[model samples]
Target: MAILSPRRRRSTALTVAAVAGATAAGVCLAVGSASAGTISGPLYRDPSSAVVRWVAANPGDSRAAVIRDKIASQPQARWFANFNISTAQSEAAAYVGAANAAQQIPVLSVYQITNRDCGGASAGGAPDLNQYQTWVSNFSRGLGNQTVIIILETDSLALLTCLNSNEINARNQAISTATRTIKSANPNAKVYLDAGHSTWNSANETANRLRAAGVQYADGFFSNVSNYNSTSSEANFGRAVISALNGMGLSGKRQVIDTSRNGGASGDWCGDDNTDRRIGMYPTTNTGDSNIDAYLWVKPPGEADGCRYTAGSFQPDLAYSLANGVPNPPTTAPPTTAPPTTAPPTTAPPTTAPPTTAPPTTAPPTTAPPTTPPPTGNGCSASVAVNQWNGGFTASVTVTAGSAAINGWTVTITLPSGAAVTGVWNAQASGTSGTVRYTNVGYNGRVGAGQSTNFGFQGTGTGPSTASCAAS
Candidate 1:
């Protein structure tokens, strides 16, 4: 997400100790008045965040209690995305040093670009490549062996299509230069290129942009940075991108997803109210996927998404609703675990390392090999169709429930040799290089007699001509 601090009217609050001492069921009760303390990682907490200032200024406001308990209490990323080059070094040094002293890993969201946000709310960025390089060098200097996760530019990947060839080439060069510079200055620092969100770009398309922008030099790419997509959707998106990247020879890379403010309905990202959004899976490195490194609080909760107040301002009413609207895990759930000293993969390393260049994007294979018909009377059937382009394809699956209603169903298919399922929607899924499985989620699980439900996924491969389906 774009992180711009707009000029806003200030409100007047209680002492930090008083806010810390205030208690609610799921709110954290850390020694400091701020800090939700729900994360199981040593993510740095900015002592001077807008939320903290808001809480201190207006403790007597009706929404103060919930705002303090929810927004201020959680550990979120500190964005150094502004083009304030004059004092950028000192600011980075101070933030890095503070986290180092506190023995925490600082998660930084870096957003300086030549053309940021495409003339939108977060429109300003470095005037040219030289400024960006200078800024990146200064930003990199702060990483003196202290662990840092640099979230490189939010709209970098998704915005490539908007630029002409010259701009695209320049953007890619700047990104490549930045990746090399950061790693050269601090090899220990983890760098993640931003790949927008699931709903914005297909995994195949994002992977292509990320590869062109030098994702190979970085740790991996990040997703759901400023949006409110579901955890599984982002997870699937990452998987697909990683798989496609691997096909491009960037194997063993990883991904991290932003879970902050995704725990609720996650319907219309622009329209969803604060009450509809909850703090998603707590910050942790144990994100159930071998390819995914962490679920982070990238977009700090309570910060307006340009819709409510000016973008990035902390609103008390929004904060209160995000805290009290839905049930989050109690603050007692692991007060604060340190981030991993080494980047740990949640699962075993991938076994397949295929050619990096995807086959030419073209129409699907003309014919399918004849196969046995699906068993009848079991009340289920599966049909698969594929549409392919250079390096990637979208596979659609239609599951027809036969004569009777089924409580739940699972569709399993073998991917074409080099293909990998990167993103899936309308269902939950899991798999390996050759096989993938899709199961119904709550809203779409039950299938009435003779009815069907359609689910589709994007992947990197040529074709999966046919798939076998079974049901009980």
Candidate 2:
């Protein structure tokens, strides 16, 4: 947390689960996204995240619904900010193990560098550089031999203005050692050093510091973690850094941006609560940019910046404001007829891309994008298409008119006991709890013969469910 008196920063791995390649865009998980969105790969969703836990414990909380849909349902990086070596090792193991079980890639951050945050509000780390290396080594052992992304310290390079040359050299040495420790233990682990944000330092300066800090041995560097800079701006900044790195003979390096809270205007405020912030794009590797590796939610929304609340603690109001009116691209409404759907309308990148066409007539053997049996009931047929990552899932229900036309449709979905709808769109829900009932909204209710319409929802506590539907 730099005291530039403006928005300043920001931590937190899993194995390469087959599911790690899938994104988690909730309502934006419309049809035809399989090849859609600038996003590439998917990241793991930690079920035990602050927002998920809060939503589950306070299922009836006033803000649970919005928070769950907007915040909890997406994949978030897990931080190992504590200095305790033993606890951190086991914690890392458990998280990566769970992600491997779910077949998704996990993102992690290691923030235990000595004298972190310039002794600002979020200051504190390992007692010294040697102990920090030991901590990172133990932590890396837990990464398994699967694909995982590790975001190193947030301000290690960007905030070097306060450190003397000797101190900076020592910190850079520690970073180099940590990178070697992580890569040696598990080559599958992708380690990203910190480059801060676009405004903090010039590209050349950031590149020089990154070189000193050992970016060559890591995956690349990350920008805007725990900051409020726009994604586009961060991407451009990343390009500058990459160009600079290339000039330094560091080719083939790519970067990931933290889109956790940069949906609104960029700012320089740090360590204080700001209500105008909004969650940015969902995490994805399909950034559509060659230089940019992915767009990630490195900083989980709602966690305080150490001013309004303790840093890393959940702040419900802040979470709500960040999630409120999220900027996800609009999804297509149900069609008038039920023929196989074309790609739904897409504005830009998707958090979790969904299949545009109808679910395969026959189920595929693969497990990542969990699809349901071909379904038809009463006067209408329904299909449940679900794409889940780690703890949360997004599903689309395509309802088709039968042999005859209908004026309206009602669909019933049986959620598992602990499952609930965190958010929904393209239809109105009867209740978020228990067996939820869904009905048509003001438009798209009418269906010509063989016509079709659709709706989608985001959920927690469980994955996809069987749905029964009918037409009026």
Candidate 3:
């Protein structure tokens, strides 16, 4: 998100004599004070919002609730719930309904249409395009003008060894068909084509796939849907892809990249265990570029794609361990330390008599001086805090500004060596090489002074850590 300039106010009353008197009297008056600010409640910050409340009330697994809360508490963050078609459909309906009730726009992932696992790890989608279209229609029906962001399918465009040309074409066709159907159903909805991040697909290759997949029919393309690449690299790569798409007659088309998981880019095809890739970029508003729309968080924090041993199961203990930077169930030993000692003292001095001098001839009572207000905490300030869980880590942040209520603010998180971002929300992020820049979208307005807004991201990494956040 870009920053807006502050407006200047014109002064009305300015008397030289009054100014002199106030200065001479050493009085201070308040001026340029920021307006009242607000700190969003933890509950309000949850990305899942009312969806979590409803899910909590009607519970099965509390893990979902924990994940939802983590997402909501920050500025740019999101959660990914990988379920079978039946479950995905049901959850999609519930989320849409909840979003409607709260009058809040929600982001939803359409995960069950193709070979969902990219031919590995998890179960695949429908066997054919016809069946996939039906599923797409079903998902669309549930969304009734409720704002939603759809991360179509993950890694579908990936050129895998097992995926033959025919199979790939069939999958790409299904994506194109689904996009067309969804847009026709709900014109207001925002759709993003999953481009498999910078690591999987090169700029030219990804653009061709997007074109073949009929990207023009949708809002734009989506990159890094579920991978762990940083936002900066992704943004640069995405810009390249968008340029390619534009060259292919899809220019001026907007695209969104998932920042949820890629605070840092991976060094190899399969993520390494010795990296500290984490960032604090958030989603941003429409940039008015046809090639890019917004960077978004489409993955949830703390949800494991699959364990080091097991493929795709939710391991809470592992999740917590990774998020908090502990080695599994942490040891119980305390460190040894030395005890403290004593200190020294000092002496006193004598007092002097008060001076009795007639006060200078009373000038007209001096006026008070103008007050110097505290620094404005509101209008566009950001910070990034990183935490480790299981084998992965996440970054939390807050962005604030005066009276200019931030719909959201975008910041880029530079990850430490050997780290990879795995998830994010409230913003769209893209990058590689241990750096992710998050840009906020759907920003409402002026975030008043003194108030701070929060956002976060999650990723996988290894070893000693360091992270930083800055406006993009």
Candidate 4:
């Protein structure tokens, strides 16, 4: 049987929360007002994510362009799954602090339940339940009252067959207490427990385990963290789980799905091979459905799953393969290279240290939203490149100096009517809604001859497909 190796090297996240909430029967409930949470807003992007770090260090690497635009620029979850109790609070604070500064919701996964994954490749959690609970309490302290979303213990409720009756009871109780602990510390916290994926565990069984783990106190449940099951299958399975919970008298619970790796057909969960899968939807809270709070990137892309590579370490080739397969229409895995030899992980830390400073501005992805032809003027040229889904889009504008070095530059863009710019990074902008003018920030003001600098923004409605550059 395949077991999870849902290890991650570091943490950073982006999430979409909808205004609509769901009941046990998948009926929509009003959260605040009918209008809130309907549009996907900005989620924090960790400039220091594994993929971001790799792209920065290896800008010259053959795979840098694809990875930088596709994986690094977007928001992904930061796993607080490692056993670093002494530093847990501080680490969580630093990561959450950065997201708060950006005014974006940060998605996190707490995966340190005792004997998690049944000693499979992703094993070795807290030594005992007491210490684990203590760790949970300390971690909660770092949340600091921000709107945070947490995937509580990926395999705690789903992967329980390895535990005998008594052990299962203890594990479930541990989860129950931990959920309470997290929500208590920050009222704004939304805790979602794991329900495995659609392929594993029947809805009744998953629902029973969730109740034992205190689902009533949590915001809801999450599915397909590091797996590749299609989004529709998971959504259908979530409804079934919700229905089962309602039958058991637990109602009004909503669920989130991890779309990070579900862009393609579901793959084996217990292996080191991560190529057959592709990147799913970018992180967003604007899921159209009410019962579905958001579609999150719980498992950051490019990290290995412990079969052909070190569990949790970012592999550029795998990153290339996954990103290259984007908006992948669901299909059977193509005949290709056989998976590399499987090996047990030597060391796996669930989260990496947080970025203390502002993340560097990101570049445009080479694929996806096709770029408009660069129209040149005033000794420079610029391109408006985009990535879009449903009601939102993100665009990166790259400005390149002419043959002569330019001391300063400004770019004016006319957005499609009704487009609203929510956030801008790597540059200063004058307009928020219509015609917007962008100028180089202090550090990025100067560009070498023919060199380029870029800035990006998140917005609602149509994104501009063309741009013109003006530089002196």
**lDDT score for candidate 2 against the true structure:** 0.64
Off by over 4 Å in 3: 1-72, 75-90, 264-275, 283-291, 308-472
Please, what is the TM-score per model?
A: 0.63, 0.64, 0.50, 0.62
lDDT at 454 for candidate 1? 52
Best by TM-score: 2
Model 4 C-alpha lDDT per residue in residues 1-472, reported as the tens digit of each score: 1123221122222122211211112112111111112223456677667776677677678877777666776677887767878878887888899789977778888877887544534456798999999999999999989788888977567655446789888988888999999999998898998786665567888898889889999988987676555576677778899999999999988778887755653222222443455777666665555667777888787776544566677888888877884643212212222112233211111111001110111111223332343333437777766544345555656677777777788888899988887656556789788889888766456776766655666567777887777875
Residues 30-97, model 2: lDDT tens digits? 22221222223457877667676677777677887788777777778887776887776677888899
lDDT tens digits, residues 409-461, model 3?
55656677877654444345686336676665443122345454334444556
- What is the descending TM-score order? 2, 1, 4, 3
TM-score of 3: 0.50
1 or 3, greater by TM-score: 1
Candidate 2 stretches with Cα past 4 Å from truth are: 1-7, 11-40, 266-272, 327-472
Task: Name the candidate, 2 or 3, with the larger TM-score value.
Answer: 2
* lDDT score at residue 225, model 1, on the 0-100 scale: 67
